[model samples]
Target: MLRLIIKKEIQSALRDTRIQFAGTFLILLMLVSVLVGRQGQKQIQKERAEAQATMYDKWVNQGAKHPHSAAHYGQFAFKPKPVLSFLDLGLDNYTGVSVFLEAHKQNEVLYSAAQEGNGMTRFGELTAALVLQVLLPLLIIFLTFNIFSREREEGTLKLIHGQGISMRKLLMGKVWGTYALVLLIFIPVICLAYFLLDQASAGFDPHVGVKFMGLLASYSLYLLIFVLLSVIISAFSKSSSFSLLSLLGLWIAACIILPKATTNLADKVYPTPSQYEFRKTIAEKVENGIDGHNPSDARLADLKKQVLDEYNVSKTEDLPVNWRGIAMQAGEEYTDQVYDHEFSKVENIFKKQNRVSEWAGFINPYLAIRNLSMAFSGTDFHHHVAFVKAAENYRRAFVKKMNKDMEVNDKPGTEDYRVDKEMWESIESFSYEAPDIGKIISVQWRSVTALVFWLVALFTLASIYAPKISRL
Candidate 1:
């Protein structure tokens, strides 16, 4: 009987010209978005690779001075685009891809794609995730809003109910039919994306594969919730139009308005200090105490004296190491400590701000799904933070290595000491490996749980109340 009902619903849906048009339009949009996103990803990858190559060629081929001087010259860290980023675009379009590493200062990643144009981007970009999250739900609502009410309005519901059919079976059949329609519209695009990515890149990693599948599964569950919720609204409402308007309002609240408003509210509530203020405060603290940027700081004078005494040298110049290099390295280490302290403070503030949005998953499934999707795609705040942390780690290692080399090779004084450019070439450049998707999923476990709860809640509601349609 359920199979018969599903077949009836599918045939009825296909026979409707409006439904066919919507399905066609959505499929076409998905295809176009996939193509555009892949092309954009390729272009970005090429540009970043070229930029990193240029930096390396300039640093290695050109003659450099001392190892410490070379540290001051620094290098760039270019974030590579994840293979499946094309499917979601997630935070990629919002976050910066490149960070400049140099001596004694930490630079913020620059060049956000969001800041490139006028305020037009506030409407959001066209991507597979956007379509699946926002538009596809609306399409599902359109198809399911009248599932029971329209039959009642036509007096067919009474006839069917009188025939002794169960309302649960009827509603389940309807939901399944609508879900199939959505899959038909979405699956082709997903398959095509996989094929294109595999052909373009070496091959998709298993981790990426898991993330992609998780994305698809979460999105489908999200769509099911919308279908069931819409059906419930239709079952309870007196008319089709009212059900639609209610569902539309719910959609706007969930997908469009709430996420942005919550993020802004989180920012206001947390009130993180500006970057300038943060840096200034750290710098002032350092100056008043250790003066981490200056090796000859008064606070460090005792330490320097102890070192001199231990070496049995009357002057820093009389020691085995170059005093200037030793002082510069000491200064750098102190400043690094200060920066790390400040960086942690800033990170804590941002995490507090994001926590508000994270908790908003209960109010809005779109928020939950968006967070999960971006997390899996390696384009969330966590992923961005990982890259910054990796860069800092690389900076500290590079600086320490240079300081160790200076201690071993430097002549004490006379400003006559220098390392060959060959030594600089021998030092390894900074490289970043993106974290596995499993790690990302683990970090975003709360959002995943929220999505699952949403699905279970809706399914439970549908199962319980759907039979009440006959009462209506």
Candidate 2:
């Protein structure tokens, strides 16, 4: 009987003009979004690669110059584009994609896509993930919101009741049948996009397949929760109009209103410092702590005395190594400490801001899936932070190499200590590999738990109430 009901539901839905139109529009929207996203991804990848190569060439080919000067003439570190980012852009647009690595300064990532765009960009670009996360649920609501309520309104519930079919069985059939219809509409478009993507790629990435599967699984559960909620609402609704309005209200709250509201609340709770203030704070700390460039500074004088005593020499000029290089390196280390401390406070504030939304996933599955999607796509804050850390580490090594060269080879009294391209070439280029999927999932346990809880709670609600819903 359940099977028959499911079959009837599918057959009837298939004949509906509204379902046909919505499905077609969704398919078209996804097709365009995928193609556009792929093109944009390719363009960004190419641009980053060319820019990085140019920066590398300039650094390596820079002729003989002062070692400290060379340290100041730093390189740019471009963040590698993740393969799945084309499918789900996440924070990649807002977060800058490259960082300038130089001496005594930790630069923020530069050249964000959002920075280049106009006001309309704030609304967000249409990506396949957006369609799935926002629009597809709407279609599900449209399909399932009036299921049981319409049956009651048209007096078909009396027929089903007269046939002695339990409301639980009928509800189950509608849920499964609607889910099957969704798959029918959704699968072909996704498969077509995947096929195009595989053909478009220059090389194979094994992780892409695995990550894609993870996306599929996550979206599957997410969509199921919506379908279940829609059917359960329909089953209890007094009329078709009430069912439609209720589901629309729920959709708007989950998909639109709550996301914005939660973000605003988080911002109010944990305010982040402005960029100028953050930089100003770091500069003040470094200035007060040590002046590596100024040998006349009191701290540098102390450092010089301490270094001379450690070497058992009365004067810096009498010492074997260059005092200037030692002072410069000491300043670099002091500045690094200041940057790290301030950056840590900023990072903590971001984490706390993110936490509010992550926990809000329990109330809105949209937030849960949004965070999870960003993680899997490697566009989340954690991934961006990892890239920045890698760049900073490279920058530190780079400055150290220059300082060590001057200390070892230059005369202590030399005014212009120079090193050639040979010394510059000694420092390694920056490289970053995104954290593995397992690590990403570990950081997203809150969202994962929320999704699981939503699934269980929806099923529990259906089980308890479906049997008790009035037939007429």
- RMSD in Å for model 2: 2.7
Worst 10 residues of 2 by lDDT: 289-298
Instruction: Give the per-residue Cα lDDT of candidate 1 at 239.
Output: 86
lDDT of 1 by residue, 315-403 (tens): 88788876656666777777777878888888888878777777788778888888877877667888888888898887777777777
Off-target runs (Cα >4 Å) in candidate 2 are 196-206, 290-298, 413-416
Residue 368's lDDT in candidate 2: 95
* RMSD, candidate 1, Å: 2.4
Residue by residue across 1-472, what tens digits does model 2's lDDT show? 8889889999999899988999899988988888888788878778887888889889999888988888888889998777778778888888898898888899999888789788777778898899999999999999988899989989998899899888888888899999888888678767966786676543423466666776777888888888998999899999889999999999999999999999999999999999999999888778775334433366788999999999999988898998878988988898898898989999999999999999999999999999988887778898889888989999999998888888877876676667787877777667777777678778888998999999999988888888899977
Q: Candidate 2: lDDT over CA atoms?
A: 0.85
Whole-structure CA lDDT of model 1: 0.79
Candidates in order, TM-scores: namely: 0.94, 0.94
Candidate 1 Cα misplacement greater than 4 A, ranges: 117-119, 202-206, 289-296, 470-472
